[model samples]
Structure formats: C-alpha cells, structure tokens
Target: MDQRNALLGEQFGICPICLKPDPEHVDHDHETGKVRGVLCFSCNAALGQFRDRPDVMRRAAAYVEGNVWKPKLVAPGVYRLPS
Candidate 1:
C-alpha cells in the first residue's frame, strides 16, 4: 500500500468520506469550511466542483437552462466573476 494511505489507515482509522476502513488525508480550504473527506483525489475534486460557491454554479447552470449570457466585460483592471 501507499505510504500516505497506510499512514491514514493507521492514524485516522477510516476515510472521512467513504466511512470505510480506507485511508484518507485531512483536506481544507483556506477560505472554506472543514476539509471533508477521507476518500481518493477524484472524490475531493467532485465535491469542490459541486458544493463550493453554489450561486456561481447556478450561473453556470444557464447553459443547462438554455439561457444565453452576453460576454460584457467592463474595463478590466482585474475583476472577479459574478456569483
């Protein structure tokens, strides 16, 4: 088994997400909530894409809604995307 995975198995006792005897690492975002998982890399990515910033995700949901958004970017000195 992988070193980190084994360490997780020995230390954490179970993967945080799977709740299985699988190994896991503690993950967290500097600007977000508790690091939520003891699963593999793929699961973490899925959670990030799904749960983080749901409003922005809703805006992205436009294509699924069959709506169109104009690309009107005002004087760009550097701006954040709408949420």
Candidate 2:
C-alpha cells in the first residue's frame, strides 16, 4: 500500500489532534521536515497559527479550559502571571 494510505489507515481516518475523521492533510515538523501525522484542516491551520510552539499551544488550551492567568502587579506597568 502507499505510505500515505497506510498512515491514514493507522490513524483510522481520524485526525490525531482533534479526533476528527477524514483528516486529509499531512502534518510535519517545520524545523526538521519530519512527518508527525495526519490532521484535519482546522487543526493544521491552528498549528501554523501557533507557530508550532508547544508552550503557546498549552497556554491556549489552558485559556480555552478557563484556566486564564490572573496577572499580579509586580511593579509599575509590569504584570506577571504566577508560575
């Protein structure tokens, strides 16, 4: 079988990130150009928007889950989120 078809079959036609079916786009690491997996269009676009930064993605996920950071005033015009 073709490698792409094999991969799609391995994923059961679902986007690994969003668990949506019929993921037609191939996702890869921009830095190394290595194939990561298949992803739906929206998820693939979202990764691009996030610049493939895992930290930023985690924060975004946290924000979406209502874990918004409450910045503490440290100094004049300086606010910091608790670590």
RMSD of each: 7.8, 1.6
Could you give candidate 1's per-residue lDDT for residues 1-83 as a string of tens digits?
46555557554766565555654445566376554445556546645776666565677678679775656566676544544
lDDT of 2 by residue, 23-83 (tens): 9888899999998888899999999999999989999999999999888988999998656
In model 2, the clashing pairs are none
Q: Give me the candidate number with maximum lDDT.
A: 2
Error of 1 at 45 (Å): 1.9
> Which ranges of candidate 2 are over 4 A from the true structure?
none
lDDT values, one for every candidate: 0.58, 0.90
Error of 1 at 42 (Å): 3.3
TM-score attained by model 1: 0.32
Candidate 1, backbone clash total: 2
- Candidate 1, poorest ten consecutive residues by summed lDDT: 21-30
Q: Give per-model TM-scores.
A: 0.32, 0.88
Candidate number of the best TM-score: 2
